[model samples]
Target chain A: MSLASLAPLVDAAAVGDPQEGVPLALYLAVSGGLFLLGLLGVLTRRNPLLLFLAVELLLNSANLALVGFSRYWNVTDGHVFALVVMVVAAAEVVIGLGLVVAVFRQRLALDVDQMSSMKG
Target chain B: MGERIVFTIAAASALSFGTLVVTLKEPFRATVALIGTLLSVAVLFLLLAAPFVAAIQVIVYAGAIVVLFLFVIAYLGERPIVEIGDRLGRYQAFAWLAVIGLAIQGFVVLATTQLPGVRDDPKQVGDIGSPEAIGRSFIDDYIVAFEATSLALLVAAVGAVMLAKRAVKSEGGR
Candidate 1:
């Protein structure tokens, strides 16, 4: 490709602001990083409470992307969806912590790997 | 230039605190890190001009959900954690690979030219997050989904009570 043809691509990158708002990629990159951190936590952490927290991180990252796209499109739809996700996340945490508390009371253990008796 | 500075600061704080939330040894300490992450994200929302979502994020996630998590932790009390073999060490390579892969994907998607630019002057876009706008959209287009969320919350409350009450009842009987 000619250097002249690539000039526009570089210029697009150089454009600090678009009329639409902030660049979509910036938000997506943060969201992806947050999601991966949460993934690592869920994979490596044994604590159920931390696991719930990691899941919360994942949900928050998704919310960030939603709001970003809402701004990108200049619409209210993404905002509403993000709101719904928040509600669902709240509910999920309540049930999750409740289960953890119940299980802890029963066995005084929160080691999820040890909860394998359901295989019976 | 100002926007660039704000974005940089917010993104840095959000990512660092998010990492801390995952990697911190103490769950309570991790929860504090989570608050930092949420607050930074709220700032990003403000930058995006969605003040309403920003406020909701602060009030709901930072204010309510996090407090709920702390209450549970306090009630449960801290216990000595068993050393699960060094899973992080074993998975460290894979984690790095996955993160790099996600970054590349995001870059390619973002680089695509298919995005439609803002429909109107970005600054001229008025109160998309205002209650009037949100309520109008919520009722006109998303009424069913909105109602579903309320129902889900109701179910969650009852289910939580049921689970906790059952545990208490069993203990009392014993």
Candidate 2:
């Protein structure tokens, strides 16, 4: 779903009574904010390693939102998706870090701006 | 009362640490904040009654993933800190403005909307998040996706090893 549709759902979730349980809106807000922060980091940062961390944050933010929705709907689907995403993220990191290591070893340039060989 | 209090604390800490992970100058410090952010999210998962997910969040994310990052940080020793001057271009200004606008919009939506019973009944969701239930669904409903994930992971492991070895050989040859 588009982020616009999610806005009211988040607001609606947040406005509910809290004594019964944690509100879905609060979870959504936190996850959304975290996701945005990670995006900003990815756009602004130069360090490849830091970029990796930012990407992790982005994935985790998505996972959090998924679990929240799963709980809201009372389904197991979100949990499974989160689990699979976790595996995918782990694999991505392994390969990405390996590439980073290899490149650093070759020329010791850690900044993204410096690695322009692929820019065509 | 306790749930609200815990949720407030966890949410606040998680957001702050998440921001730190993004804005910190030193990569190592950012890594630490990232750990804190993950741990706080784990607490939120626990509060949400998904104990299994919370445990995995700790073991895989806080433990394995962050440690892997630390290993990379150690390998790339003494990298220059991100310079703050002479780099903020026009796009950077627009990006910051966009972030602020989004935050304001989120605040407005959160403050204005009201939906009762948005979450499921506590009784209904109780078993759904448990490890046994999740595992059952994994085997029964998501078997194909699960199998694909395993295959992908194996390939990634092999690829990572090969890539690193090739890089080492090339460097040596040079």
The lowest-lDDT stretch of 10 consecutive residues in candidate 2 chain A is: A9-18
In model 1, what lDDT does residue B76 have?
81
In candidate 2, which residue pairs clash? Answer: none
Give the per-residue lDDT digits (tens) of candidate 1, residues B1-174: 567567778999999999999989887899999999999999998888788889999999999999999998888876554455543367667767876787666556555535554222333456677767878989999999999999999999999999988999878863
Q: Lowest summed lDDT over 10 consecutive residues: which window, candidate 1 chain B?
A: B115-124
**TM-score of model 2 vs. true structure:** 0.86
Single out the weakest 10-residue window by summed lDDT for candidate 1 chain A: A1-10
Q: Could you tell me every candidate's TM-score relative to the true structure?
A: 0.85, 0.86
> Candidate 2's residue-wise lDDT over A19-92, tens digit each?
45666877878888888888888877778888988998899899998988888877888989998999999999
lDDT of 1 by residue, A1-120 (tens): 232432444344344644234466667778888988888777667678999999999999999989887877668988899899999999999999999888888865576666678866
